[model samples]
Target: MKTITVKRLTEAFQLEVLAGADRMDRVISRPRTHRPGLEFVGYFDFFPMERVQVLGRKEINYLLTLTVEERLLHIGNVVKYHPPCFIVTSGQQEIPYLTLFCDQEGIPLLRTSETTTEFIAKLDGYLLKALAPELSIHGVCVNVSGIGILLRGKSGIGKSETAHTLIRRGHRFVADDIVVLKKLGPSTLLGTHNVTAREFLALRSVGLINVVRQYGRRAFQDETRIVLDIELSPWQENALNNELEVIPQFTEYLGVQIPHIEIQLQPGRDVAGLIEAAANNWYLKQHGYSAVDEFMKRVEDGMQQ
Candidate 1:
């Protein structure tokens, strides 16, 4: 299981330490955070002690209503299970007894300046990205216009070169060679290149070149959800552009399927232009239009005449 440390959270969010500052390296084994609303009222049954507990405005106000000893008793029962940490959001007035109890229990008590809602949203998003299941695929992903197209082919099949051409033509580079895919959602796979090699793309003889340095920031994208899979095949005379039927194709990765297209590679084939057209075609299809279907309808109507 992938576990993130409490120290990482503090560093990422710049959380101020209230207690147990020495226990920053404690692992947050669970991805989901919790609001111990029930635990505050002495309802300890089924308390999720493994998650990062949050004390928002309501909980802090409720605790403030209690007598000093009562507050300690309730906080004592809550932290007795030894949760990973407690985050005091909304920057409310400090509850010294709660911090004192957490300090004694060696549980990290941290506070963020952001409101409870905003902070939780950001925290969950970060945790999800950090801990999502990962899969590395062999391909080059690019953003054509706004479409994320994954170019797949065997080694030395011009995947890198083709992506380079697209970059020159104003498209964005996503990943090259090995694309790391994170299953961020049930049907969404986010793909990105290795950070160490993020700025570079390779082509035979020419060697590795930094696209960002060459083309500026607009030519590079950190990650994209692959919306199209384009496979490049060696040119076959008479076999290329032979599809008469207008059926759509799809490819799958980590249980998510996206539209698919194939383009044959040959001298003067205009492969880059074809890919751009494919992306535009995909946009058209999404908006209830298909060039092939429309062409077929026109042909059928003409034949009847």
Candidate 2:
């Protein structure tokens, strides 16, 4: 039930208010828009009331063909449905009757200079992002070798410290501390830095430092699609010795399963190097090469020989 107010849309799209200024507070709950071409001729069975109604060149021309009384009757019928708002595209001219009816009914009527197709395309994209499902996770996201790696584990496990080391090695930082994950589609999850902590990393000894300021623009990324999840945990002897003997692991986020791995942490261990190697290994797996699978195949060949 997320909604974007008409006032917000006006500001975002720079829409011109032709009428119904008092209705700027109207809320738009649906990202999809509706074109009332068929409904213009007295068909209301399939008319969508929750979507923003669009009036383009063809719709306006058709309204002109009707006599004043017929036009008013038709427009009044549509207004009775109480749509969220009406947007006029192709901004060539204004239909006085339509504007008047919308004003009287207190329905926001907005005009845009862009063509029908362009306006709809942009509006759909904007709405999709604005209404996409989002969730926050306590982890660190980084872009290593063009692959997004999300590091997750208990606090004090050196997630930020590992990320800092990776940053020094020329990898791009996506987010630290709080990672905001948004479902871009059925299968895609996009991760970005939380607004309050963008480009800032917290360290026990150094306190808070801005990574962007320290490393410049090349060290930071606005967002990245998460492809790998690595969990850092306290070292348990021989816990991961059989990792290569088992099937690869995966973690589910927003209904999509992503490749997952767990790395044990201990003092003096090269955590950053291990993560970097994992990223490279993930890249190779994506391109049809897996070291574990290859090694197992080699063992089978040797046994046969």
Candidate 3:
């Protein structure tokens, strides 16, 4: 199971440790956070122990309504679950015995300056991205007219060269040589440069070049949502003709299906321009304008006449 430590969350969220610093190594397996208001009221039937427990304003106010003895009893019951950590939002100081109970039980008590709603939203977003399923593919990713295009092919097939050409044509580079992909949601795949390969590209005779330094900041992008996949293959006599007959090809990655196109690589072909056109065509298709569909409709109308 994937897990994040309380210490990692603390660093990521810039949380201050109010108590239980020794238990910062506590593991949180769930990407979701929980507010145990019901558990605070002695309802523990379905409390999620593996999640980070958030003590928001509502829960803190409820605790204030209880007598000291009643407060300790409810706090004890909740802490006994050994939650990954307790985060008090809105920079609220600890309730009467909160720090004591957390310290005694070795449960990390974290405090963040952000309000309850803001902290929860930020934490949820962070955890979702931290735990998202990720994979790396050997390819070049670029943004052509705001559409993310992933170009894949065998080694030395000019992926970087094509990317360089596109960069010169005012396109933005996401990654070269290796593209790291993460599934943000059911239908979205986010692509970024591999950490070790960021801002760098390898090309024949040119060696290693820093894209940001060579092409300026506008030519490099931190990440983009991948919308299309294009696989470059060495030119075959009949492949180009066959590709024209195919419509709406798709490839599956990380449980998501993305539009896929295959192009033949040959000497003297404007591959970069082709990639740019592919991106424009994808944008048009998204808006219900398909060249193939329009042509087919025209042919049907002619036949009917």
Best by TM-score: 3
Candidate 3 lDDT for residue 105: 93
Candidate 2 per-residue lDDT over residues 1-305, each given as its tens digit: 66889999999999999889998999988878989988889998988888999988988999989988899888888888889899999985858887888888899999999999999999987887677788899999999878899999999899999999999999999898899988878888889987889899998889999999999999999899999999999999877666565467899887878888888998899998988888898788779997878899999999999
Candidate 3 residues lying further than 4 Å off, grouped into runs, are 242-245, 300-305
Question: What's the residue-level lDDT of 107 in candidate 1?
Answer: 93
> Stretches of candidate 2 above 4 Å error?
243-246, 283-288, 296-305
C-alpha TM-scores of all predictions: 0.89, 0.85, 0.91
lDDT of 1 by residue, 187-303 (tens): 787888878789789988999999999999999999887788899988887875566644678887878887878888998888999999889988897899977789899999999
RMSD of each: 2.4, 2.8, 2.1
Sort by TM-score, best first: what order?
3, 1, 2
Q: Report the lDDT of model 3 for residue 53.
A: 93
Better of 1 and 3 by TM-score: 3
Clashes of each: 0, 0, 0
